[model samples]
Target chain A: MALRDEVQVGSKDPSGFGVHRKRFVYFALIGLFVVQSGLTYTTSTEVPDSAATLSEQARHGEALYREFNCTACHQFYGLGGYMGPDLTNVISAEGKGPAYAKVFILYGTGRMPAMGVSEEQADALVAFLGAVSATGTYPVRNMDLTVWGTYREMHTDEK
Target chain B: MKSEWTAAKGFVVAGLIALLSGALFGVIGSWQHVIPGVVDAIPFVKSRPLHVSLVIAWIFLTAVGGVYHYLPKIVGAPLHSTRLAWLHLAIFIGTGIAVVVSYFMGRFGGREYWEFPPVLGIPIVASWLLLIYNFFRTANKHKGPWPAYLWMWGTGIVFFLITYTEANLYLFPHFTGNMVRELTVQWKAYGALTGSWNLLVYGTAMVVMERSTGNTAIARSKTAFLLFGLGFTNLLFGWAHHIYPVPSALWIRVLAYGVSMTEWIILARMIRQWRGTLEEGKRGQGSMTGRFLFASEAWVFINLGLALLISIPAINLFTHGTHITVAHAMGSTIGINTTILFASVFFISSAPITKNLRVGFWLFNGSLLVFWLCLVGAGMVKGYYTVLSDLPFQSIMLRARPFIVGFAVSGVGLFIGLWMLTWAGVRTLLRTPGDPAELDIHSAFLVEGPGSPAPENGHAVRQGSTTTLQP
Candidate 1:
């Protein structure tokens, strides 16, 4: 076969003459933009409503905490594993707000390894954890955090 | 003839390595269950790396050998650099040995498939670069716009380098942050190296098929090229499934699915076309390599099914980051790539076989059949219990013990096949009766009835009295 014919058969012309190729590229770009915007919007808006009493930043922080599998280790309100200390009264003990918790997470102390979570993720985790600390009810459903909520409730009642 | 010699040496080395490793893996795999708590031993972890590395080494050596033999014939020229080829051989063997040593010492970089520490990794990378440089430089001096087979091989080499670079990033000082992205990249790299390299081998197969059959129709070549291109695209983009749990946008997921589906479509089309082309008598030929090649095509579909199953958004939600993915990977690599590599070896070795060659053919095919069934069956059982059940990881490991045993059992068949191939390759190197000229003449006579004047394009062009076939 001729080289020109071979090229034509193998690849769609890049000159935007082909209607299907042009459409595909346009659609892909549009779809990418939409997904990026949607994720950003969901991250920003969905936080405050789920835990309405908490600050907007705190709500976003909560979303990050859930997404990153934090609860797999540290306990909160009798939830999570015993691998790390309970953060139920962490804010009160630190004598500060969510910022102290964020700092601790950012630069982990003693046996706690720094998880290398991004700054944004750290802030969101702090806000969410702070909200949980304030309410004393682990924000389980909002993040789909998969904590044994029933077990936590039983332990909380016992306490 | 020189190309044939090089291929023979490669076959011997690769075959020996494969047989030894297969035996070791089989023994270790069987013992892991029989001996209590042996799975937890440091040696077990070390052995896994050794198994994977040896498999990689054997396949690569075979691929290089096949390419060296076939490229010269395909391009109508002798090899550009026999010295560079020897260098390639040395680098592979030396680095492979270093990797095995490093693994046993617990100095591995600790990544699936990329376990070889940087000490060995650097040399391997250098060897690959040298190969790419040599191949491309030689290819540039040739006349034709790159043939599909050459393109495939070239692309495989280039992508192998890219994959290695991405893999090595994990060893870098600043390798912290974006765990999901890093993991995705790692899997993508693995997929490309294996998938693209498989395509390259398949391309080589296409060339051999054309040479063997004297059927270089544009349609068949185009179909092969398209399948390879589409397969490459799918293999690279389909890695998005690995990062499903990460905070990546949905577009990534969509891209992964779209590309992967396209890959399957092209492959399906190619297999359909190849099946359609198979003549009646050709189908029953006792060429062990031919049967294995046909079986490998079947495996391509099997791999496609597993790929699509895991690619499904709903299924992937559960299967992602699970042992099922590992099964899929093994199925594709061992089931598809290694099978094709062996087929290529069989094709090359056909040039010089003196004995019936059919014995080797049957042994190899039978071994592969056993290997495929045992591995697939074992993988399915392991995937189901490990992924679906809420059992502890250790309990799941216990459930997988039998499958591990199955793999070991299957390795026996693979060892037999490797030995047969080595024997056949050695015979070919010795200018045995079944070499290229003899097979070509026999096939030509089959094509054009006895007493008919052999056409110029027919296999008679290479016929010489000295090339004997003792039957």
Candidate 2:
């Protein structure tokens, strides 16, 4: 095929600045995505003991979590549903612990229907949550803002 | 048209089927939220994934199908290999069947959007490779400078495979063993995956617009590519906004917040051009595509505004994990993407503006608006009570019940409207012959060439007159 007869990229612009600029922007953005992904992976801090090998019981509770779709109402790290409160630090938070979570799961609350999970399942669920709580906190409410637009807790051990 | 184009049509049919099935499950899932014991056969757990997966399938299948159908036409060549396209379709349909079966059998292991067994992901990756090979081979033939839509499609196709693979990385223990890394990687993949597909869908919208208006300058203009660049950039870095509440590094959240705010450029552009677009819509009253393009513009305004508001860390404090988040998702997926795809489907099928379709269009949009508002209502109640008052989850939900009921009821209307549109699309796809003359599909609706007279309505219509197409 004779190439000159065809519309080449930037053909619409006699100056060709638009085409060059766009290509520059596109490649630059792709590079940014790669860099961000790398930084996120390398710098991310896991919950304490979150990387520890999971116990068999905790694994069972994990399965129960998905099977019942607890995520439909509850969130971890503030990512799931809004109907329920975040469970990220619930097990470790003041005035709430595994025992507090267990009662609601096994017997249900006034508003939340009983999940009908067995007693053993409830224990496993609490164990799974305990493991998650060991990972991190939620709501990121400590608004220690830096000049660079980040919370102080994100970079420091202020919490 | 080549027989290869028929394969593209097959994907549309498959996508529509998935759309209806997904909507059915969506309705079931919503009602289940209200009446818990209503559908015991398939509980909310099963129904939610089925809804999410199938709808996601519809977007991919149709957007990719549009790419397949248009790529050769735009490139002025036949597809590199028809057999490969069919192979891609076959593999995808096979994978879909397996996914549904797995869901029904209560087998799930992957992350949120991809709740099916992890093993099924293999075929998906393989099928995508076939598409990549076929796409580049054909698209490379275009002689002129590649248009914005071409770049959009290329970026979308290549990045979808990349991000999708990234999403499944959790199957590796290294990623899964750490909660922070796991959550970060999961959402990283999801946000990009969504952006990749949006590029594809938005590319289709651009092509449809260029062809309809016969405006070569539109796609080649500096502003268009600039917008594409901005969108691409946001896709790369803005995803972390979805996870600000996660105790990830501060840099990720800061970078995403900046990236997300850039969308105001697009919103401003839309506002600047609003008058011209409204005039265009008035002139295009006779064209369903014109109407749809206008509708998409309005949705982009509303959705982008909401998106920008929620992207802020301060506002996100209340909105994260709330129904407001769902509202944002719905606004983008249904309000924006669905309308754009509908326009493309009508353009390709040459379906007419009939009374029934008009009713369906109004019903879908009207119901969706209400549905969106009800979600915002529910989220406001929940976000306030949960954040400020420390109410129990059930207590907040109890207060939000009326809105929830409204959402569920309106969902039924949305489904019915979508069904009517889908049925009409199916008929058009089945009946329309492969017209080789229609290879230059983009220009089919152009009414602005030299010596071309506008219709008596003083507007450009589709290539074939209204009388040529069935209502």
Candidate 3:
């Protein structure tokens, strides 16, 4: 059987129309991707020192988080489910602290099912949340929007 | 049937089984939301991964199976090592079983999406190596300038290994120490991982189109290569869109947002060619491959529209953690990928039209449309309540409950439709395949060569004479 088509139909030029121009466009797009990836590695910040230091209890709580699939409902920093509020700073928020979190974890709340977590698990979860709370806040409630669709964390004296 | 191709058929059958099982678990998981303890035997945590991993396995297994089946024909050579292909299949199936067992035992040590025990990653990676080696070895034999599909397959195969390895980077203390870096890396790997499989699946779509239409020029066309390049660029840098809310680098979000919008070019191109495609769809309606190809086109339009909208930061703020995200996922995986795979499956099997199949197809698509809309509705409600109101989580869920119930109920219809189709597919796979030469020519009415008249008889010509069918 013949490999190439018999009639040699369509455009004959190997690179299609404007071959050299297409090559330039392809390279340009690739260059943009490389630069963007580099920026992610360089500009992104890491976890703070306090939050990075995970206590044994927090470690267990972290495991428990995955084991229970808390992400199925709860989120940290607005990245998990909409079924629960962002818990990034739940432990540190005014009028809500470790005790508030522990009670919810140990027993079922209105919408959130009681994970049936034991008292020990609840303490560890609180410790985990306490550590996470030290990292950052969620919803970035104070948004000073820039033209670029990014926000600058507006200064507030409320804290 | 070629003995060498038997394992490829087996892989596809395994994928269908996985699809059915995963979807069953999905139904259970969704209903758990409607009635809190519906499946007390398998809690949401366990059910979620079972659904996620198995469906994911379906995509990989089927996509890879399509490659194995088609590679030899396209490359004009038998696979370099059939033994390695078999080993790859064996290892993947064994690993899949292991993953299910771990999920059953409630042994989850990894992150979301891949909630299996971390150790399972090792075997999974090893099996992938066999595939990578086998694919490259086989594909290298093609004796011409490579087409866009080959490039897509090569990139997808190599990158999946890279991304899969990167996904496990959390084992390193340096990565594990910083939560921000950890999450960024995780999403990065996941984004690339998804892109990799998409490349494989899209390449399969191209090949199936090329073969069905007998239009080799389409694969080699300038437009095809440009689309492949655009998709590759997005696969590389567009992943950060998923992590925009993670408080990562501002540049990551900015770059991803820009990268993602480029797909509008593809959508626009599709729009330009819509009339031609509709004409082609009508011509090919008799062929199962034709119907599926048309279905996949519709899905691409719908899913791409949703994806483009959500990639915008302002909209993502509402949709990010909601069922809208799930909608996007389901749209891509089920709506687009699954349809394309089905086309490939029926093409390989030469599945004929039956009343049952026609009914299944309509039912599957109809149920999916409702299922998809319900998810979007749920997400919109949840997003509004969570972001704007001070409503509690349960209250928001209560508002979304009707849509969630609708989604779950439609899911049953989808499963039943899938079951009938899968049963037909499995029967096709188990039966011996006929000579490709005879089978390929008979389907010529489904597509035409570039500028060539539809042959009165089914056979197409090459070198100005009737020739053996290659695809």
Candidate 4:
């Protein structure tokens, strides 16, 4: 078990990842995996009402988003291309409401290429953003971090 | 080795085709970013999936071929069922074709990277199960404790099934309810899924290293296991770094940050490892496989630095949505994974070094270096501006456009290099087995070390012959 012994060149490793220890490691990995899976499903994730159900128009916008490959440029919840701002709370963010989002969608901002959607389509895209915003607050800035790294705003329903 | 062509080499052939075709699509996709509507027939929307899926196919096909090829050799036995092996290939290829056609026809529902329809996932899942059954049945026959590579392969196989299934959790009503949860789960699954395949690809790298050098001890070394354990831990916990901006519980991001920082330990150990592998160290400069392995080492360092910095919460807030993330992804996939896989390909085929491969190697590496730097530069500019200036997306993109253009131009060179390399690899694979120039696995491996082929034309020759390994 000595660190020096474990690293010897071409050294015969009996307990160094030996088959005898395979079962133990395998179980440990699976156990860790199960707990993580549970945490991902139960503890860390939640849903608000507006997020739990999207309007019919928002579904259309979702489809259009995928069809346009908008994700290649924009992100939701900070998990996309940096080419554009995070759209997670764009519609609800102060000074930037649905009208502001609609104009950019309808007429291509020199920055974001015009998505070439009709006015109605732009409305739907904004609606989609509205639903996403309803999901939670992002860039979770002003919260004190607990020692365990849990956040204060697990509810994600802040408007 | 007479019967080897039927089961294993078929996958190699399919994989090479995938690599060549994928590289072509990747070139097209990159161009679209610079010149919008450049390729009308296949827009970026379609090309992205074609490139992503096909390149992914190359990795799986080749990596799976490696496992199939090496399992019997290492276990000192014939395959458990060659019929099942062939069936596995048959289904895989069959499904692969369907996936490609779906992309061409513009039928897509699945998320990014895996943009094919959700139903197509059934065959993929089913076929992988066959691999699991086949892999365990064959690999279990090894006489002693399984080497580090076996553990890697086994873990990769099992985890692919687990994480892949996890990726589809979006289909369930529970996960889809909240965009936050949905996005978090999506990336969590994908992050780990990426890790699963890395295990597969990295396992292939280690196999090529062990077999070529005839250094079984390296794969069985304690250090190798410790490294594998470390990587596994990261795969489990470090994934959440990908979704740092999501409003998920802070614990996920914190845990990932802590785990990801452990790459430093991996890096330090790797430096020590280079010193320990005396045979590889001495002969590596001369061998094609050795050169590729070394290239991967350099890439690991470069990308790990970027990945670690971005894992930091403050840095990530700016870099997460930018070209920097793309740079990291590209560095890992193309720089590290592709190079290692190519090493495995050339090593397995025992292809003699040739002019085409030499040109291909230099061009590939050279173009990639330019491409990688441009992306990082673009990412830095975009990240800084997007997070700071009230500049519209256009102004920021305009600033980044020069880098994007360079990236696209370099992509063409990269594709050309891949074309030449794929031709070399496939031609060598298709050559019938009885050539005197080529050494049979038994005879060729009897000499210690893959001493690098002097030419890329005929057979892989051993340079510094040391100990003999029993076939």
lDDT tens digits by residue: candidate 2, B164-185: 9999887677666666777888
TM-score of 4: 0.86
The candidates' DockQ values read 0.04, 0.32, 0.32, 0.23
In model 3 chain B, which range of ten residues has the least summed lDDT? B456-465
Q: What i-RMS does each candidate reach, in Å?
A: 13.8, 6.9, 5.0, 8.0
The deviation in Å at residue B171 for candidate 4 is 0.8
Model 2 chain B is weakest, by summed lDDT over 10 consecutive residues, at: B462-471
Scored by CA lDDT, what does every candidate get? 0.52, 0.76, 0.77, 0.73
DockQ category of candidate 2? acceptable
User: Which residue pairs of candidate 1 clash?
Assistant: A58-A127, A61-A124, A61-A125, B288-B361, B351-B435, B351-B436, B352-B435, B353-B434, B354-B433
C-alpha lDDT (0 to 100) for residue B119 of candidate 3: 92
Off by over 4 Å in 1: A1-159, B1-8, B19-23, B30-42, B218-220, B246-249, B267-281, B284-286, B318-323, B351-389, B397-407, B423-471
Q: Rank the candidates by DockQ, best first.
A: 3, 2, 4, 1
Off by over 4 Å in 4: A1-18, A46-64, A67-69, A81-86, A93-125, A136-159, B1-4, B272-282, B434-467
- For model 4 the local lDDT of residue B307 reads 81
Report the TM-score for the A-chain of model 2. 0.69
Model 2 clash tally, residue pairs? 8
What does the lDDT read for residue A62 in candidate 4? 74
Lowest-sum lDDT 10-residue window in model 4 chain B = B453-462
Question: Quick one: RMSD of model 2?
Answer: 5.0
Task: Give lDDT tens digits, candidate 2, residues A33-145.
Answer: 78877877677653444343456677668768876768766789768755457787778877889899999899976445686799999999998888777665565555565
